[model samples]
Target: MRQIGLVIKTEGNRAWVKMQKGASCGEEHCPLSSSLIDDSQDDFYTVCAINSVGAKSGDQVMVEVEDLFLLRTAFMIYILPILAGILSYALLNYFLKIPSLTYTGTFLSVGIIAILLKRADRKLNFPYRIVELGTASVCISCPLKNRNEQQKLKP
Candidate 1:
């Protein structure tokens, strides 16, 4: 379902929007679901979609949610790479005892792996992307979705 909402809060890599769909003046408080993070206030909770619409406080937004479980897993996928890199790097030396590889090598390897993952990540078709203010240079793929509908997103 697609929703038109307003951004209520911004927190560590996530923005919480109080979906207009669930808002009612007489309701006193609006209940919201966050795709990434929940940072809501007394009357409203924040949404956690990407800053694609350039959605600011009080700005209306159109959002599409797939599935609740899917949303949770999507977030996991985005975080797994960094976790893997950190875990592997730490284990490679302290536990694996492949001491021949220097710390520089570990860092370099992590960087290279991250770069490669990011390059591959560009092909995904996620629900959101930060819409560029002017130039299209800083647009990044939504790490939360598939690859075909990518261009259909804001960035």
Candidate 2:
């Protein structure tokens, strides 16, 4: 999977890339979507990736990650909660034989699993690389591009 991001900063071998929230970017499971990963409250999120392309700050870079990795992440994020709920309901119903208790257990299990996943996601670094720099996706509307144009126009 490949996505475009702006290199916000660089530290040694890793580059912190600011990613836009692409609601329709297919099945690519963005690990940074978890609030535990970023403390900042904003529409965008930042992620750390290996600086294979030696990209500098403000560069529009194409990041690459394995398809299988994304698939596993998606499953863990989307499917695990449902599975926990089903398992909780089954266990609770069998042991207690109460309908309301079973439903409550199911909901509680799902919420607990979700919270765990969110916390774990903070440390889950899906391996990614900065494959290409200055890709065609960097258009005039891009922040770095507009900054360059504005500087050129001044003085």
Candidate 3:
């Protein structure tokens, strides 16, 4: 969805865009939210926003989200550790009949699961969209590159 709004607020790397109904005619209206993706953050390296629309404060700009699922998956990685810990404890106690080793096994399983899941998510793609606040343009895009392209670019 396109926001076609102005920069109502900006703190650090995030910006909130004010949405307009039809066109921006200098009137107060609903506002939408957007964030500037910084390449310094590895996760957002391939999702950098192309600022060709000349975005500025009070200047209607557009923002886009390329991969929504991938974004959600990133968050899931955080929860996996907790789930793994509990599952480990339960499995050891119930299946293996090893109650005494539950706690240690639980923590170890959590660490392992978290690391593995994080790596997996990095290699997958999430549902994404681009929000052009200024032009009120939104495009669903993917951060994943084609296997052939990757092979060609690799050293």
Candidate 1 least-lDDT 10 residues: 135-144
- Candidate 3 residue lDDT tens string, 85-124: 7778888888767666777788788878878886885786
In terms of lDDT, the poorest run of 10 residues in model 2 is 146-155
Rate residue 51 of model 2 by lDDT.
96
lDDT of 2 by residue, 1-155 (tens): 66667788899989988765542253226555544565665546667899988999988787778999989998999899988988999899999999998888889899999999989998898897888785555443433343354322110
Give the higher-TM-score candidate: 1 or 2.
2
Rank candidates by TM-score, best first. Answer: 2, 3, 1
The window of 10 residues in a row where model 3 has the poorest summed lDDT is: 25-34
Candidate number of the best TM-score: 2
lDDT of 2: 0.74
- The TM-scores, one per candidate, come to 0.33, 0.72, 0.41
Looking at candidate 1, what is the lDDT of residue 89?
73
- Candidate 3 regions exceeding 4 Å error are 1-61, 66-71, 96-100, 133-155
Model 2 residue 78 CA deviation in Å = 1.0
- Superposed model 2: Cα runs more than 4 Å off: 23-41, 137-155
Kindly report which residue stretches of model 1 are placed more than 4 angstroms away from their true locations once superposed. Answer: 1-61, 67-78, 94-102, 127-155
